[model samples]
Structures are given as C-alpha cells and as structure tokens.
Target: MNRMAALRQYQKVNSQAQTAVATPHRLVQMLMEAGLDRIAQAKGAIGRKDVAAKGVLIGKTIEIVGGLREGLDMEKQADALARVDNLYVYMMKRLAEANIKTDPRILDEVSGLLTTVKEGWDAIGDQQPA
Candidate 1:
C-alpha cells in the first residue's frame, strides 16, 4: 500500500483501540487534546500557506468544541452551563475569525482558552457523570 493509505489505516486502527478502552472521562480528555491538536496544526498550515488544510483543521476544531458544548446538560446547573456555553460560542467565533483573517494569534487565543477549560475538566474526579 502507499504511504498515505498505510498511515490512514494505522490511524483508524489506533482510534478504534482507543475508543474501545477509553472511559468517559478519558474520552473527554481525548477530545480536548484532539481539539488542541487540530488548532495547532491549523496554525502550522497557516504559516505554510496551506489554505485547504488550515480550513479543514479549523473546521474540525470548531466541530469538536461545538460537540462538547452540545453535550452540556442545561438542567444540571443552569448558571454554570450557560457560562461555559457562552465561552464555547466565543471560542467558535474566535476560530472563525482566525480562518477569515488568517491570523495565528487568533488560533493561539482559542487554544489557550481550550487548554484552560480542559485543565478544569481534568481536575474533576470520578464524580463526573458519564
């Protein structure tokens, strides 16, 4: 097989393995990491003038963050959820702005915000609901 195809196969298998073994908390952490990874890659793509990759990576990052926001339970703690939801929306807007203006600084801003959120989530223990 070609190098690209082999790499894709490897990634697919690796993802499947991770999914099979990951707990809910682990999955959340994984998702957070993936989002950060995509944004970092998008920043690199921007630097390299690879417009298509930049767009794809930024879009994927937005989707991941949006999924995280959508999974929030509004009834669990309305005030806190609303705050976090707003932050997610803000992050999405920043992501779009980064894409539109081709600004790596905007990507950095969103990455930092995501890292902060991920750190808080990481601090949560077994009490977090699945």
Candidate 2:
C-alpha cells in the first residue's frame, strides 16, 4: 500500500484500540474533540474555497453533535441538561446555515459554543470521584 494509505490504516487501528478501552466519559471527550477538529478543518476548507471538503467536514461535525445530543439522558433530564439539548439543536441549525452560506464565521461561532460545552464537561470529569 502507499505510504498515506498505510498511515491511515495504522491510525484507524490505533483509534479502534483506544476506543475499545475508553471509559464512557472518555468517549464523549473524544467525540467533542472530533467535532472541534472537523470544525477547524471546515474553516480551512472555506478559506481555500474548497466547497466539497467544507460540506463534508460540516456534515461530519453535525453528525458528531447529534451523537453528543443523543448520548444525553433526556428521559431523566435536569433543567440544565434540557438547555444543553437545546444548545445542541441550535448548533446543528447554525452548522447547516454555515454550510449553505459557506461562511467560516458561522463555523467559528459553533466551534466557540462547542468549546464552552467541552470545557464544562472536562471540569465535571475532573471533579468525578476516584
């Protein structure tokens, strides 16, 4: 196989190994990190006027955010969590708008919001009992 393809296969195997041993909390962290990375990549695509890459990246980000929302236990929802659900919905909408408009600024807005959520989530993880 070519070098780039070989590298991708190695990365895929490594990621699968990590996922197999990951705690639920760590999985969520990974999802958020993936979303952030995709948003950054989408922004770069926009700068390059790479419409196809931008669409694909933003779509992946939307899927990641949806996964995060689904992971929430809305059946046992606290008020704060309900608001988080709403924020996720809002983020998805903005992401769609960003894709349609090819706007990097919208990606920036969504990235900031996701970062805020991630920071809070990380703080909660830090406070977890050992």
Candidate 3:
C-alpha cells in the first residue's frame, strides 16, 4: 500500500478503537466535533470554488446532524430535546441551501449554531461523570 493510504487506514483503526471505549457522552461530543469539522472544510471548499468537495462535505455534515437528531430521546417529546430536533432540521435545510448557492455565510451560520450546541453539551459533560 502507498504511504498515505496506510496512514488513513491506521487513523481509521485508531478512531474505531477510541469509539469502542468512549462513553455515551463522549460519543456525542465526538459527533459534534466531526460535524463542525466538516462544516469548516465545506466553507474552505467554497472559498476555493471546489464544488464537488463542498457538496460532499455539506452532505456529511447533514448526515452527522441527522444522526445527532436521531440519537435524541424523543419518545417522551421533552421540550428541550424537541427544540434541538427542530434546530437540527433547520440546520439541514440551510446546508442544502448553502450547497446550492455556494454560500459561506450560511455555513458560518450553521457552524455558529453547532458550536453553541456543542458548548452546551460540553457543559453538561462537565457536570456528569464520564
């Protein structure tokens, strides 16, 4: 195998190992981090006028947000979680718009929203034993 391909394989294995041992809270944290990273990369792709990369990155970010939404406890329809679910839906819509327009402002808006959510999650993590 080539050096870069081997490195990617190693990183994938390492990430899987970390996920296996991570607590539930940490898993959510990691997901949020990944979503934010994808959004940032998508914004960069927009700056570079890389339409293909922007589409793929935004798509990944949408999937990450969707996963986070799916993970929410919605059976009881708790007010707070319901609001988060709504926010995720909104983020996905904006992501689609951004992809079509190649707009960085929309990306920035989504990034800020996700960062706010992540900050709240991190605060909760600090209070919980993990």
Candidate 4:
C-alpha cells in the first residue's frame, strides 16, 4: 500500500477508537463502579447504624454526583439530566436524615434509588460526542 493509503487507514482506526472510548455507556459504567465502592463502605456503617460513617459515605456519594452533574450538558437532554440532578439532591437529603436518625432503612432506600438511576443511565443511547 502507498504511504497516503496507510495514513488514511491509520486515521480511520484512531477515530473509531476515540468514538468507542467516549460513549455515555462508558461514563455510566464508571459511575456505577464508583457508586458500588461507596455503597460497600456505607453498608458496613449501616449494619452498625453508625451515624458518622454513614455521613462520610453520604458525603462521598454527593461528591460523585456533583462531579457527574458538572460534566452533564443539561441543554442536550434537559429533562433527563434535570431528573437525574433532582434524584441526586434527594439522595443527599435522605442521607442527611439517615445520619441524623442513625437509620439503616435509609441506606436501603438510597441503594434502591442508586440502582434505578444506574439502570436509567444504562438504557440511554451512548451518543456522547468524541
């Protein structure tokens, strides 16, 4: 093959790799992995009904959600992003309440909420621009 043809093929391969790397599915997968780690830490606290540890986990989750929200473009998917943001805020509130009450039930509630959020995110098309 000529030099020009080889260059074109290389470019094509590089572009495809970039596209595969930048999909929304990958973003969701990253978030789910981080969330599972946080949830595992929180689970121990929940079992003991330890308010302080619960608060720490809640703070970490909030940080995760905040980071996600900052990267999200609400204009592109206004309704969906808004709903996700609202859920994140609600989760923060519930976490606070759980900490104050030392309640394990709230941990279960947050787990369910996070699961739903993850599922919803996964269902969306992975059309993020490369």
Candidate 5:
C-alpha cells in the first residue's frame, strides 16, 4: 500500500479502538446526566409548587429512562438497567401523584432516588460492561 493508504488504514483502526474503549464510559456518563437533569427539573418544579410543570418534567424523565434502556443491551446490563428503569417508573408515578395533590414530598422522594442512581453509575468507574 502507498503511504497515504497505510496512514488512512491506521487511522481507521485507531478510531475503532478508541470508540471501543470509550463506549462504556460514554454510556455511563449519558445515563448519569439524564438522571441528574430529571432530578433538577423535578426539584425546581417542586420548589415552585407547580403541578403542571412537575407533570411535564415527569414526562421528560420517563422519556430519558426509555432512551437509556433503548441504548443499553439488556442481555449485558439487564439487572442494573432493570433496577434503574423501575426507579424511573416509580419516580414518574410519584410525580404524577404530586401533581394531583401538589405535594412537594413526592418531588423530594424522586430526587433522592435519582441521586442514588447517579451514585451507583459513578461507582462503576469505567469498568468493563457487565
């Protein structure tokens, strides 16, 4: 192969290896960011005692969780992802209840749950995928 062709091939292989090395860390970061965003929105809505706003945030939270699940391979991370999914669903329900009753407690509960999930994700520390 010519020099240019060999350099291009080398770059391609390097790019693939980089992606392989980064995938798990990227996934964890994405999940953590989503969870943190949801928690922040929920907290803001609760602070304002806005039922409609809380409902909207809850809907977004559900979407984020669903997206996380879609990006993940269930066979590889089924247990952890399942648990996170369940917590997300539960948070949605709590948000709905808070909206109906304008209860700030529900928001606090969901925020705590999201915090726990974020901590768990941090603990994984870029390790190999489960």
Candidate 6:
C-alpha cells in the first residue's frame, strides 16, 4: 500500500479502537483537552505569523467548544447547564475574535476558561459512583 493509504488505515483502526474503549466521561475529557490543545497551537501560530494555520486551529477550537455545548444535558440542571452553554458560546465568539485579530491573549483567556471548566467536570466525575 502507498504511504498515504497506510496512514489512513492506521488512523481508522486507531479511531475505532479509541471509540470502543471510550466512556462518556473519557470522551468529554478528550474533547476538552483537544479544544485546549488547538487553542494553544493557534496562539503559537499567531505568534509565528502563520495566518492560515492560526485560522484553522481557531476554527477547530470553535467547533470543539460548540460540540461540548451540545453535549451538555439540558434536562439535568437547568441553571448550571445554561451557564455552561453560555460559557461555551462566549468561548466560540472569543475564538473567532482571536482569529480575526490574531490575538494570543484572547486564546489565553479561552484556554484558562476551558481549564477551569475541565477541573469542575473532573471533580463531578470523582464524586460520582463508579
């Protein structure tokens, strides 16, 4: 097989394996980490003046944030879920603003906010019965 085909095969198999093993909590943790990673990379791309890369990374961050928002359980706790939804929306807007303005500080703000959210989520996971 060609190198490109081999890489695609590997990725497909790896993704399947990950999905087979992932619990809902693990998936949420993965999404949060991915979002934070993308925002950090976008910040670096901004510093390097790589406009295209910055835009792409920031776009991924926005999508990841939106996905997280969609994952929230609206029926569980209305107030808390609404707050998280609002935070996710704010993060998405800030990510777009950062991409448009090429601002690292805005990415920093988003990253910090995500980190706090992740911490809270993890704490809840810890308190839950296995």
Q: Model 3: clashing residue pairs?
A: none
Model 1 lDDT tens row, 60-82: 88877776776677788799989
Candidate 2: tens digits of C-alpha lDDT, residues 30-128: 778888988999999999999999999898888878778877776674797899989999999999999999988999999999999999889989999
Sort all candidates by lDDT, best to worst. 2, 3, 1, 6, 4, 5
TM-score list, all predictions? 0.82, 0.85, 0.85, 0.65, 0.58, 0.84
2 against 4, candidate with superior TM-score? 2
| lDDT of residue 21 for candidate 1 | 57
Instruction: Give the Cα RMSD of candidate 6.
Output: 7.6
**Residues 4-74, model 4: lDDT tens digits:** 33223323322223323444455444555465566667778878877677678766765555555555566
Please tell me which predicted candidate would have the highest TM-score against the true structure: 2
Write one digit per residue (lDDT tens) for candidate 6, span 39-130. 88888898899999998888888877777776777888899789888998999999999988888999999999999999987897899898
TM-score-better candidate, 4 vs 5: 4
RMSD (Å) of each candidate, 1 decimal: 7.9, 7.6, 7.5, 11.4, 11.1, 7.6
Better structure of 1 and 4 per lDDT:
1
Candidate 3 worst ten-residue window by lDDT: 1-10
Query: Which candidate should be chosen as best, given lDDT against the real structure?
Result: 2
Clash counts for all predictions? 0, 0, 0, 0, 0, 0
Candidates 2 and 5 compared by lDDT, better number? 2
Candidate 3 residue-wise lDDT, 1-130, digit = tens = 1223322322432334365556667777777788898899998998898999999989888877777777777766589778998999999999999999999999999999999999999999899863
The segments of candidate 2 whose C-alpha lies over 4 angstroms from its true place after superposition are 1-17
Candidate rank order under TM-score: 2, 3, 6, 1, 4, 5
Judge candidate 5 at residue 94 and give its lDDT.
72
